[model samples]
Target: MRVTGLASGIDIDEQVKKMMAAKRVPMDKMSQNKQLLEWRRESYRELNSAIADFRYNKLDKFRLANATNVFSSTVTGNKTAVTAEATLTANQVDMKVRVEKLATQTTATSPALADSTTSKTKLSELGAVGNADGKVILEVSRGTGTPIKLEFSKDDTIQSVLSKINANTDAKLNASFDEASKKLIIKSKDYGADPFTLNGEFDTGIMKTKTPEGNLQIGEPAKVFINGKEHNPAQNEMTINGVKLAFLEESGNEESVITTRPDGNNLIGTIKNFVASYNNLINTLNSKVGEQKYKDFPPLTSEQREKMNEDDIKKWEAKAKSGTLKNDGIINGALLQMRSLLWDTSTKVGNKNLDLSSIGITTGEYTEKGKLYIDEEKLQQAINNNPDEIAAMFGGTKEKDGLFQRMYDRLLTPLTSISNKAGTSRYSADPTLSFNEQSIMGKELTDLNSRMAAFSKKLKTTEDSFYRQFNAMERAINKFNMQSASLANFAGQ
Candidate 1:
């Protein structure tokens, strides 16, 4: 602390502080500009996130065939014999179905063992023969796949063997021990006519079973009759004309009938959900573009913030950040493109040109700015009269034509533009990774940072110069006072 102002009778520290404040004006403005740029970048990222949610979650799925076609089926007569499920493209017809037989799995059971037998019983206790190393190996094979060899010591328990068998992926067999009956049962994991074989000493010695040619109980395939024509499948389930039928039991002489039809309520609900999401997204974008800007509310400087309360600072920033994305060219372009796609009627449903208005969807008033409104009654009538046409309209048979597909395709351009301007990492889901620094806004921020740093260094040098000048003036005044005092004393003397 250079104690100045005493010699010159002037407050040197206060004067220098005033001058420095004036010199810092440019630096303060730079800081404010940088803050505004950061806020704008944040706003762009938020908007990108919202658009992505709508595109991937709603539009992407709505353009698929199964999503647009909503249909259901009901089974009448002998419901216990079979159950049916229908997809969107299922034909609306009543078909007679008879389940002649249900599929079964291949299984084998060993004879009753000693009363003391348990899952933990050792292989030696079960009188199993082993190799010279006392390792009892079992070979199990299913279908035409390579056999799985399970090796166990004679001291190994029955539970251990069963666990090894169940854990083997190649064997695909389920092994269990019935403690009550004192019998070991092996069954194939899949239900089919194909047979699995069990070989090796563990099977012959402990199980006391004959060779694979005589001992196995093979599985049987299911037999069913649809419209007086027989169909045999390895499994009990079959799908015909988009209708999946699962046979649960055999129908002796009775036949079950499956009926399918269009579900208007479900289709309406799906469309309503889509409409809600679209409106929500567009509403947010519109609000952002129309948000009012407060020119007087520039970002506060650090020194300014120190003098104000937290609440006041927050309120000030709210106004300052309001118009970061207002009237943005990219966002406005996206909105126009989306509205145009919705209004276009170039695609056709059957022989008639397909349009939102034809199926009860229409835009709101001009002031509302492309908001969609649906007439539910008219939509239901359209669905009931020509459901296929409605499906084709939303989910086009070919790509690039349907309403959802067109919207999805059009959104890519604006999304890409925003991403390029704001910058985004490929791993967007990972919050730890920041936005790419090579983007347009990123490069501008970098340049601004460099300029601010250079200006700050210049300001520091200027402040030091002012302090040096003030000290020099104080030293000169002190020397002059000393000389005057000495001269006056000599004269008086």
Candidate 2:
């Protein structure tokens, strides 16, 4: 610690501050550069997010082309007996359906056993006395699946045997014996054509003693005839000519007439929604491209910001960040390309006359910056007259992509270029991006920061060395003045 001045009588600390202020100019510039890079990076990512929103949320949905959600069908003739659903590939169909027989499951009931509440009352006690080689093996199977077997002996209790069967069947079937009725009941797990069967062997004594035998019940397939054609569906449901038919019961001679046709109302709604989404995104992108840059408002230095209050600093930053992406080549280029694509035509999906204009979609005036506006009446006409063409316009082939696909492709190149320059949130996990080590601006910022840190360290050293030199100079001056004063006193004496 050295005194500021004893003989020099000057504030060395204040002077050092002024000298360092001059030295910090380059450091402040580096800091400003870093901030500007951060702002530019943020701008690129924001634009990318908007692009992604349009591509995934809006464009990807064109795969269906509003057939499932829009242009739905309503069947009037067979409302209760036969129902139908509309799909993307659904064509108009009207047919007669007659269901002759519905499918049914198999069931079997065992003989009653009269016994007391004792484990000693086994299958042998229940009139099923088995010989030495008399073991009852029950195998239950469904369809082509391997049969599951449950084996029992004459010594086994009826309750124990029933518990084993219940535990082993999984969910395929149920086996239960009522306590009051003393009758063992077995039933199939499912209905329809599946043959739910019970084929197993029983001892002679049990087979002879039981009243209503434990023979297996056979299952039956559903008999359905649609439009005079026999449809023996394994299950009760069948899909034919884009219409699903489910059998509720035997309809006998009562014929169900089903009619399917495209409804235009739903198709128009989704088209309008698409147009509005496109307009919103295009307007935002156009405004960004045309946004004016405030060149006079350079980034604030740390020292300069410290002199101002928080609100003033915030205000200054807002102005400083006004046009980070304005006139940027990648972003503006992407905008122009997307706008051009919106005007372009594709032949892969919609052939000739499949352009947006054919379906009543058109661009706005010159001042509107390529915003799409739909003609509702014309759009409805196109939907009603030929919705297939409209669908093809939205969902085109890969080689000659449709309207949405073309727009989506247009943004991909520019988005990639911008991402390479500024990086993205996906790159935040990368050490090179997070530490500003690899990307275009990131590498530049990293070098600037390194130089600033070194410069700051040199400044600190220069400041300390200057303060020590000034202190030494002050001591030398004070000693010389003392010598001069002593000589003057001696001369006067």
Which predicted model would earn the best TM-score?
1
Tens-digit lDDT track of model 2 for 297-348: 8899877877999999888888899888887788778777876776675333
lDDT for predicted candidate 1 compared with the true structure: 0.83
lDDT of each: 0.83, 0.68
Question: How does candidate 2 score on lDDT?
Answer: 0.68
- Model 2: residues with Cα > 4 Å off, grouped in runs: 1-3, 65-71, 101-222, 244-254, 346-352, 397-401, 425-437, 481-493
For model 1 the local lDDT of residue 104 reads 83
Show the lowest summed lDDT stretch of 10 residues, model 1: 424-433
Which stretch of 10 consecutive residues in model 2 shows the poorest summed lDDT? 427-436
The TM-score obtained by model 1 is: 0.85
Report model 2's TM-score to 2 decimal places: 0.73
Off by over 4 Å in 1: 1-3, 108-145, 148-189, 200-215, 345-351, 398-401, 425-433, 488-493
lDDT of 2 at 221: 74
